[model samples]
Target: MHNAKPLPTYLVQRFQGWKATSYAENSAWYRRLASEGQHPRAMIISCCDSRVHVTSIFGADTGEFFIHRNIANLVPPYKPDGQQHGTSAAVEYAVTALKVAHVIVMGHSSCGGVKGCLDMCSGNAPQLEEKSSFVGRWMDILRPGYDRVVERKPDDMARALEKESVLVSLENLMTFPFVRAAVESQDLSIHGLWHDIGSGSLECYDPKANGYVVV
Candidate 1:
């Protein structure tokens, strides 16, 4: 009974079975896309977590969204170094090359990254300094947000941290020159979205009200 094929093998076989026909339904569009290149309408900044898939959640096709997934859905400050800037590069491509009209920083409830940042900000919490993980360094993007809310309350920790991280990423998004230029020209817009997985509720930041409201 245990001699059965591995799960990945089964999944791959199932995927291969569907590829030609399932994808062929959109083969014509794929051909056009190959010819003209991608010109996505929106760029989505999201977490690398498996549960936070932007494309599937938004029901978008291949060219609908220019995607960037990072440890905490962080948007780092733009730098011209030769080092690998994964999220920054994706943002650059979306803003400069794809000319995407909108960017969404999608944060979810109970995010490990945000939680880590919250813990790091709380002096009484365990120190992450001992860990050599990249997540520790990447989560530094939300330090300012952590500082802004860490003194408030304990029960509000996770949600406050999540919302603060979203705002931090939105600010970081504007740090890129191309994004700033596009936004200034009114060709681009930025949004902060927080999804509560537990309640299946969606909260979007309202610029006018300066807070998140259920959508």
Candidate 2:
């Protein structure tokens, strides 16, 4: 195997400081967690964007959330076709193995992945349409969501589609038999959320309201 370069000095120093401070203060708790393994209560599927801090937003402690991040925070419909599927694998593990009580799909405003899907669907981003484009193929999950929001004004379409991504993921999550069974059995619940980065606002999907409401 090829030898990899060392970590950046700044990151190393920051980790050292955290270990000396935060980790030191909670060493017993950390040790207990290490010995018992994790038992997170929720599974949060969120965008890969650096600005959306899942744990910080919920004030979650370590081992409190089983988190997964991907472009656009989209979950494709369940397909057991003997192919490689990372998101589906994560979902299966979270529901079946981890037995998380809640599965939350969170989207964000001004998401580049959402914008790319909008552009690609609008015929403005031909590069993303290429067969070799992983992002484009992965974003195919959001096309139905775009169709649902296409009637909105041009300026509002992007944000609408962003919220739609959360709805789409929540819907797709149910397509998995294990997830559906868990939800039906009342062992698990699903939620959709959208975060406005600039405004520091959060909105949750309300089935009764048929749209997102401020949280």
Writing each residue's lDDT as its tens digit, candidate 2 over 103-168 gives 999999999999999999999999999999999999889999988888665468999999999999
Predicted model with the maximum lDDT: 2
Q: After superposition, how far is residue 15 of candidate 1 from its true place, in Å?
A: 1.8
After TM-score superposition, the amount by which residue 103's alpha carbon in candidate 2 deviates from its true location, in angstroms, is: 0.3
Candidate 2 Cα errors over 4 Å, as ranges:
152-155
Question: Model 1 scores what on Cα lDDT?
Answer: 0.84
Q: Write down the worst ten-residue block by lDDT for model 1.
A: 121-130
**Candidate with maximal TM-score:** 2
Candidate 2 weakest lDDT stretch, 10 residues? 146-155
The lDDT for every candidate, in the order shown, is 0.84, 0.95
**Shift of residue 98 alpha carbon in model 2, Å:** 0.9
Q: Which stretches of candidate 1 lie over 4 Å from their true place?
A: 1-7, 123-127
TM-score of each: 0.88, 0.97
